[model samples]
Target: MDPFHTYTALSHQELGDRLFQGELIIFSIADELAPFLNRTKQLINKHFGIPDPQKAHLALDEPTYAARASETMTAFERDPEIKSLFFSALETCGVNREENFYDRLVLRIVPCVTSYDKGRQASVKHHRDTWGSNIDSQINWWLPIFPLRKARSIALYPDYWNKKVANTTSDWSFSRYLAEKKATPSGEKIAYPSSPQALESIDEQACFTPELQPGEILTFASAHLHGSKFNLTDKFRFSVEIRTVNIHDVKHGKGAPNVDNAGNVPMYQWFKQIKDDKKLVL
Candidate 1:
């Protein structure tokens, strides 16, 4: 059965059990999330110099829009309050913010055009995050800064949970991509990212697209094959995502199955202890 299982709350760490089983969990809007959204929207709007971020593309050209979006996203990541609000929301949803380790807060503003897909566009393609990081014990938490529709939301390919799909994980490197990026001129768009990508077509796969509202949390295993939905709505979509790893899960090697991943890098170093911002040194 291709029947999908989605829950409304995450009250504890038993989440590892459900997530590794390929279940998707959705947490309702919480008091902590509201403040984060407010602050995020404020920063986004400020960076783009627009009152409504949905129409940000209309106000500026594609290149300008991308620069502004990058500025906003970078600013959001550097802001102290945004990080605090992020961890606070996690705590409200049963995550022990003080006990686990977390990666960086990734702010994504997706426009309708592909030319603007500069840095963080790889995840919008079909592939499990573990295909790149090689760490399956991480939990991916997504928050839509704006309301989502069919065209602007994300799609998870549940049918391929245990199936093998050809991918480019065996031939991708972030360091090489950066070196080539430096060789390119400043204003020109560099070559496409060499991140993990699906080599086979998944056009006929059974997919699940959940329409989420603002201030909601979409939590799932990092190994779930997911991608951005079609952009027929023509409106820009903004969202935030962060990954956390339970120290216990790490020590025990607990996570989803590695169906076809070819990556070998242990991405544990990017994570920092929640209790004390100490890096998870190898």
Candidate 2:
């Protein structure tokens, strides 16, 4: 069977099962998803003060661009209405927003080769989300606020989906990673801190990088060995990333195989409860 498939009329649970089996599920833009993505685009525009967020890095220096990027990420996280749009969008893809929990939405500003990172960005290494979150049932939803045309923007090493590659999970911990990330000096590179990364070289020919439209959603198992290919494009890449888990699947061990992750972080409790929206640390 093809590893990548499109959404049709399956129930959310069925969708979860396919994703758990390491399938890349694609859902084209729908009604609720439009407003949700538009709201994110609006926030990006507001903070960066640019019509094309993909060029925002060119408008400011390293520090100023970082500040605006931080503000945009924080504002979207703090706004309750934006989150409502998120769940509403998920429902259109058949997720039972009432029954599942979600991690905070993240706005990724993947800078081009010419942009300066200064340790303010997420890792671009080949790794699995489960290496950091330690949650097998976690499914990631990836979308571009603008059309993505660059290669490897969100590349997946599908050959490594069920295959083992030497990684740093055995020596990593989320708490320590967070502490060190916070301690990184100004203008210093994070170098992935405590996040797990492939210690072995990966073959680029086996990678699959989907060039998704603005509102198209890409869902895949958090354990998939995915990472960004360097931004060779002249403009910055602005995109949205959301992570959610089915509690039932997590509890029943019904997700992706732990092919190689040996990390010690148990982040299941970090998700916001769907009912009361209260933070859980269990």
Candidate 3:
């Protein structure tokens, strides 16, 4: 995508509306730019020393665990075009940077093989990106490095902000679990929130799972619940995820921490009971 051209193409009002109503929006640069995107991916792989792209998997086994790559701020600083695209995605999103936008960006590449194996379920469980975060001004941008075919997709609750379950409880634990959908069925092996009550409040009609192609971007609020589905395709799945936080919103800001490490909590453990038993289907 021509960073400048696309940024100008997307109307500011359209961008604002996207952020206001839906928790997420998917976009892509023109396909004609595929060769450029591919070269960037190749460079990233060379810098990281990952195996050939053709051999990557999507399963979550020991091999999958070994497949991890990240680029620091310096990487962006090194390339002007990369920086333009990075900033353009934000500008196109109508981010109010002048209001002291303290957005942080991250780039992540997940090899396809990580999801290829039987035990490679990437259902990391639903959770808000804002939980325990002092700064509530954050959003996620997921851009797949390659095209996603059938079975490789992302699922999201379309109008999650409209759900009665949102902020229903002042109790941090109950509220967070409900918001994250990490709560399991009550009295079951898993300590999920009472499914009958929770499900009753959610709009079953608003759920959606959209498959993303290379260069496509999915942006959403930190409170939105989202996750990756098991890879059903033989091709490798790679993507660059960027997160932005409004710095002025920080109040004794703890800063964003690792999502994988949040499992130590009791509520997280309760959800895991369902996960361990493979009973969490919702």
Candidate 4:
């Protein structure tokens, strides 16, 4: 079977099974998310006082960029219209949002700028989600807020699914990272202090599907070795990433293999309990 499957090709059960088995899936519901994406762009422009969303990339260098971005993301997530639209989009894509508890979805608005600064790289380095979070059963949903053309998208190294890579996971602790992240104020010189130094040594045999259209969602397990490809384009990359986990899988240890340390705390404070109609207090 192909490593990548489309939404129409799999049922909800199949998608769940495939994800646990370490496969990635891509599907499009761009039409459903168009309004929300537009609203997000508008919100960014309004918050930053930029006339053009494309030109908004220049504001990333501002001292208040992280705080401003976090505020904008909170507003976007709290907007009733956007929340409803996003939930509907998840349902349309075969995800039972109620059944699977999720962490706060993040709005990633990456500019074309790259920083050579150590410990505070603008672009992500090759790493697995397990390195930062304890949820071995976590599954990530990623979608582009705008169309991606040419070689501009995240790549997954499928060849390393079961292969080991030399990383800093042994010396890195998620709890320490989280504490440091929280203690540091927005716009400060915060860094992922223990980022793997051997990332460049990893082979480049990755699956880079750069033709992802707007509204297409990429779903993959947290254990997948993935990272951003160099954004050669001048346009900013707007995207959203939400992580979900099946309680059953986590309880039974049925998800992807975990080799990294568990987080000191779960990434979320509460989960939307789907089965009993009651909130799952974590």
Candidate 5:
């Protein structure tokens, strides 16, 4: 089967089967999420005192932009209202959030005003999410905070579904990386290692989608090869992503093994038992 598949609509069961089969699923939830995303943008602009958060990236240096973005994200994540709205949105989309295990969701704010700016480095290079602490069975969910055109959206390399790429995971230490990231000053983003990897040479065949609106989501397994495409547009690209794993799948060994060694420890230190809210050690 092809690795990428787009759906106009899907039931909860269909979404689960497709995800477990390692296929990419794109579907809509726009009506349910637009208002929440709008509020989030307003909060960011208010926090930065900028009329347009997208253009603000052009005026500030990389570190300053990262700091301000981080501050806004921190405030947004800590807000109880935002969390409630997000979970509600997920439930409305047929996701049983109560039955899944997920760490905190993340907001990604990319401010790139030009093609020549170093801010392009902020865009992710081709890699699998499993290279992080994510388990192989984890399903990643992403949605743009604003409407995203094809040129500005992320691209996936479907041909590499079962192929290997030269990466620096052999020399990387997940535990050390986590500790260093924690030690870094607040409001700063940590830079990953810049060693050359095979992904740098495989861009010609990547697949980019049509414009993805605020209410839609794109999901794929941890092993999917994906990365950011250069933002040719003048505005900043903002998005949110979260990863979830079904404990039953994990316990039954129903998904791929963690051969990539993405991290020394599982991302969530403890998985919340849906029935009783007990902490299950990973």
Candidate 6:
């Protein structure tokens, strides 16, 4: 029942082998379930904080979404177990990051609604996660803040990088715009592909569908092509998308200036309390 031990036992690399080169790796943590579930309830306490399925209300800011991101980041970071869970999970996956104790090494939290109560489930279109330059190779640890059914899950294409998506000068080049039209009709729109040939090359790569229960963790490469599916159940799908990168590789691209101003963003955030935090204790 020791979460850390079980997490350590799970061969993330083997999970990788089962995956296509660029496929996302999905797994869950056994040790941190109690605390994680508690945190989810806290986020939904109507008397104390914000409620879900509702937009920023008269009492809340119009951009309550951004505020929620900050709140979720702070809540998860405060829990030491979640911190250990992330680092251990990352190491299990063969990713190496630079060490800077107090920098925000972790990135923003992405919350998506796949299904709502009785309404059509919100779905994200097909697209790569992030494309800002200077953005070092990053990955996402997707954990459902609450339990999720297999049917109301995310869909991802394996080896997306091998697909040859183009970004040429033609007016018809494959940019985020076309991707929005083709993939995510409501979510983010992509610009031009960073590499024209890379898209087609990685096409037809196999992918896997994963439904993450509470405390389950799914990690995948930054460049992997992935997207979420509709949440068909009546209950809300509360999940967090935690993005991270190697601290040593922080200075990689045009994302540098923004990264600099962001004050090391997610990394600085990680080292701040990872050591003393007990949430990591299985």
Best by lDDT: 1
Winner by TM-score between candidate 6 and candidate 4: 4
Enumerate clash totals for all models, in the order shown: 0, 0, 21, 1, 1, 45
lDDT of 1 by residue, 98-211 (tens): 558988888987776666555543226787888877888888888798888967888888889898999988888877877878886544555755458899989545878778
lDDT of 3 at 112: 47
lDDT of 3 by residue, 10-34 (tens): 4434543444444356565545335
Per-residue lDDT of candidate 4, residues 111-144 (tens digit): 5555422122255668887666656777888888
Clashing pairs in 5: 30-215
TM-score of 4: 0.81
**Candidate 6 total steric clashes:** 45
Instruction: Report the Cα lDDT for residue 113, model 4.
Output: 52
CA lDDT of 57 in candidate 6?
35
lDDT of 6 by residue, 146-251 (tens): 5667545655665345553342223223245446456543223233332222223333235455656766677665455556554445444556566554434443
TM-score-best of 2 and 4? 2
Each model's RMSD to truth, in Å? 2.4, 2.2, 12.3, 3.8, 3.7, 10.8
Candidate 2 residue pairs in clash (backbone atoms < 3 Å): none
Model 1 error, position 105 (Å): 0.4
For candidate 5, lDDT tens digit of each residue in 140-180? 78888877877788778766777667666656666666676
Give the lDDT of residue 74 in candidate 1.
82
TM-score of every candidate relative to the true structure: 0.90, 0.91, 0.53, 0.81, 0.82, 0.49
Q: What's model 2's overall lDDT?
A: 0.77
Highest TM-score among the candidates is held by which one?
A: 2
